[model samples]
Target: MTAQEAEDFLRTYRSMLKTWTMAVAGFSNDDSDLLYRQLEADQNVLADIAISYPEKSYSVDLLINSRSRTWAGYAEQRLPRPQNRQS
Candidate 1:
């Protein structure tokens, strides 16, 4: 997406930040990755937006990216299987 389109995304995303966040939390690993890939694909535009909104820069895709990364981190973390007991 172009920088302008990215701007539009940010505007809309801000309005839905809370809902998007909840949705992200419930997303499966694959789904989370899909969203992350979509966002990361426009990293350049996001970075540009960062420059434009320095005050709340973190509110840009960085916020979502961080959450996506958190999802990935949790996805990689799993409890170990129980060992079999001796007879």
Candidate 2:
């Protein structure tokens, strides 16, 4: 993929991951498995793009890391009482 395409793909996948993570935070038990599968698929797509375009890998990695940190913070905030309060 071209640099522009890779950037666009990364942006799209990051947005999707954020959306899915929020969905899971709200009510995931009903379709947790499906959501997990979709998340994995999106991640795989990002990895493929990075591999196919080594020149754009740095930018892709930055995007992935930024999203991951955001997701981790959000997830931490949404965790249950005991989980969130643990030392």
Candidate 3:
């Protein structure tokens, strides 16, 4: 992914994570808020990395996949892939 694509994926994923974190009726706000804050901070840090080294897509991808397999699954479907050289 390019820097712009990484940022876009982060934006979209953040929205989904926020909804998933907050939409449960039984979960306390404290828990939800804490989770959201932590994830948001991670997103910010990753965004910074993408911005600082736009060519380092693999680095950002590695961090994200390490952080959340659920996210990585979605990302595999959503993020652009390198075209096969022979194709």
The TM-score leader among the candidates is: 2
> Which number leads on lDDT?
2
11-62: candidate 1 lDDT, tens digit per residue: 7654444344444544333454555555556556666778766654666755
Q: Residue 10's C-alpha lDDT in candidate 1? A: 80
Query: Total clashes, candidate 3?
Result: 0
RMSD of 1: 8.8
Model 3 residue runs over 4 Å out of place are: 1-40, 71-87
How far does residue 86 in candidate 3 sit from its true spot (Å)?
Answer: 45
lDDT-superior candidate, 1 or 2 = 2
Compared with the true structure, what per-residue lDDT tens digits does model 3 show for residues 37-63?
666576666767677776755666765
Would you list the rank order by TM-score, best first?
A: 2, 1, 3
